[model samples]
Target: MSDVNTTRASAPQWRDLRETVQRNCDIADARYAGNDTLCTYLLKMREFYRWERGLPYSMALDRREVGDWVVAREQHWEGLEAQDLDALTLGERRFDPFDHEAVNQHLSPHGLVYGAGYGRGARPLFFLGSLIKLEDYEGYRIYVVGQEMARDLSSPPAMSRGERIFVRRESIRRMVFEMIEAWQMRGAPAVDSLGRALRAYGHDPGNDESLERMVDAEVESAVWHEVGEVLAGRLLGPEWQERMMTVAGSRAERVMRAVRDHLADCLATLPALLDDAPEGALHFYFANLGGMRALLFPQLREAYEGWVKGGTLEELKRLIAPAREHWLTVAERLLREPPETWPVSDEALPSLCPDFSGRRLG
Candidate 1:
């Protein structure tokens, strides 16, 4: 760190710079104590000086030029009168910082004042982004300038009412509390949008870390929920009717798979249900048929028994064989189609599907 001068400096230039800032601050304190324009300029100068302290002595200005720059900025804002209100209306027009006329009234109103030439011409100008609350220094609010590169400008720098006024230290604390409470009142969507603006402006709430984290979590959660819906809709496609139906479809899928597998296995076990007669063919047929009685829907089996009772052995064979074929066809079709497309029967025992299973009768 550079050592401070042990006594008041002998340099006239340093003395003049000191006298100029003090005189300006005092004049602004008297003339524009509550006038927002002068307060805004002083705030900006306070910040500029705070930052300039870190620069090398040779690079930092401590001359009448710095004083004149501050005065010019204040004058620019102070020049606006009631008649110039039309230029400040900004009805539908967007803010443009370099378009001097567009921002004439808003510059001081939004807590920024212009300054030029810090070290070199290529250096982009700075905007006072921080608020200052002078505790006992009642007449003024100090604003600090931060560098914003103007290499390319499609839009003006971010500004808001929050940055416009500097409050007392106690008032600043109250403001922070009020802002957090207000944010909590907003919905997640609004909070997310505001969070983006805050981040873009590089506004940090050092002591209000919890507030920031809560807003971030809410925004992140909202984004994930949106992503989940999009993915589910894309994957579910036309089959997805609604959220409730999607869930029901998942349950129906498991039921269809079990039914298909049971029918396919039974078909695999059948030797050859054609006219070729095996010795004790009736007993062999009955053995494979016992388990199937438990599987087939009661109404369906009853309907088929009604058709075959007191008929010839050949009649039984004809009825049973066709019933088995119908079940195999239904099972294969279910497997081929998507779950949502799988057919559900309205009738308990239809003439077409004689071997319908108890798995999903409806």
Candidate 2:
């Protein structure tokens, strides 16, 4: 076998940064209790991994939906004059955060008289009506400030909702790093140490043959469930949920099962690609690597940019094989691990590995 010099100089670990991000998320969740806009931003940031992986956008009700509920509440703000009606209409429209004029027009009716300032520059802005929405059901009002207003309304480093959310997300990232670090300190194992670590942190290890199995199951479930919802929504329109149940019902189970099986098959072949790796390199690459580049490099032009920026065809040629190999390792490992091991929660499961195996990647 030909040896590939796959050495990489290790940089500072990301443990601190990840913890900071998680702490910020906690702070944001506490600080902005009833502020729907602020809460949504913070929540999104806190859950960056889900989004980055292209998971479903957290379901929440929009302003128009909320206003409709408000109308049902208090008997539709009964006995208001023509101006009040216009105001209510405007208020309903303005809940979108993108509709500033409507919000400005209906500020008084919407009870937003407190400092309803003009939107920054010429861009429109509207407060988010509510962070949660349910059809034919009333929900609380939540407001959000747009990016432009956040920038303009700031006074000497006062954190905006965006900033707060960013901090929170960073905290989450840090927490993940710390978990990985703990695993490393324990002598990086190939078995299910991640599950054990999760259990130590009070998480469920789940009933699976291996930690990789649990992770794979969870990811598969999450992805397919979201995909089903998306497909239902697209196919059935507004009544997708009901229609999906009506049409597919138990069939959804069969479909997901098939998809999972297919995904498993794809995952199985990944390990073979790692045979040529320079020893412990695969483990390191699999644990740290992320993003689409790891999955779909052929479709990405940026990968090609590596060829353009570097000189000598040989140098470029040398880099591609290793990079591809690294990604292949990551894919292989992901398929191997259980999904429960992936999420960083307080209630983690126990590691399958009584004695840690494998060497650390650098």
Candidate 3:
């Protein structure tokens, strides 16, 4: 059979797969949707509603309609909160959801990709999408998915699980547009970094094509970070995961996450971004960089300022290797002691890692 006809012949089966994925997605959203603040919850629901309805970017949403939809969705989630994530079935064979490598071995031949992983607060996230293509990056399987067939509420654009990396272009597109929209709403006060990044890409507010282009460019950025994450995973070893689980949802977890994040960025993201990415990619990297990360490494922030003022990347690029070692050392230090023995005060968490410049910042 011709390729189109072959795919047509499998539509029913694929729909079954998508249905399973979405069902599990709803279950996840049901259990974890309340973790955010009320404002954040409402905004996410508003965007989730838009994605569910396939609304155009330019379409004006009716506020009352969105509010009502959120209420209804919450009711639906309440129903699903107690359910367990179901195993995926292909033909008559069932596969574990977390066993993505095994699952993809079955799906890839049919132009499908599946991913299941955890996010903040240890929330489970899952998705299935059309296989855009695949590649090998440093012995890792890169599963790039397009036009996500199913997704949960908190859709991260990219994630790394074991040796597989899943890049969700569809999520990236929406996230890029959302970032710009959020900025436009309040003039994105960090104009020097974020604004300049937008301008570098000719990002006209509300321009869908501009949004698409930005998303395309950012795929590399996302991939690099995840690859770094994989490397960071290797450097820290399994004890790091033990440490993360020990502190999950606590302030200390944020410090753990931030240090490892800096390690990953320094190892994989920063160097590649400085060498190959547009000036704006680097800018956006720093602009969006805040929270525990900015506090953990104020020196890097200062380095960014020097680069901004000097109009050269040397100062920035020079920091990557050393920063990588610095973060890795800090990560090992954090894991040196068991979580039960760690300090009780959240205030002491920032001290877990050495100060960037002063005594402590984050």
TM-score of each: 0.19, 0.19, 0.91
**Cα lDDT listed for each candidate:** 0.33, 0.28, 0.80
TM-score pick, better of 1 and 3:
3
* Candidate with the greatest TM-score versus the true structure: 3
List clash counts for every candidate, in order: 2, 39, 0
Candidate 3 residues 258-331, lDDT tens each? Answer: 88889999888988888878877887787779988887777788878887786577767766766676788878
lDDT, model 2, position 259: 30
Q: What lDDT tens digits, residue by residue, belong to model 1 across residues 1-362? A: 11212232234523432333333333333333333356554544643443344442125465576677666645643543212111112445544323432342433343333222111111122222212211112221222222321111111122111112111222222223344444556742333434443443344555355444433332222222223333323333333332223324243443343343334323322223223433222222232233324344344334334433543444444443455455556555544566565444334213224543453321
Candidate 2 lDDT tens digits, 1-362: 11212221122332332233223222332332223366544333433333323333223435564445444422422322112101222312314332333443443233221112111121111122111111111221112211111111111111111101111112223334445545768776634435333443343324223333333222222222233323322322333222223323233322222232223222321222133422222222233323322333321223223433553324323333343334334333333454334322223211111111252221
Q: CA lDDT of 137 in candidate 3? A: 59
Model 2 worst lDDT run, 10 consecutive residues = 157-166
What is the alpha-carbon lDDT of model 1 when measured against the actual structure?
A: 0.33
- The runs of at least 3 residues in candidate 1 whose Cα sits more than 4 Å from the true structure, single-residue gaps closed, are 1-281, 284-310, 340-352, 355-362
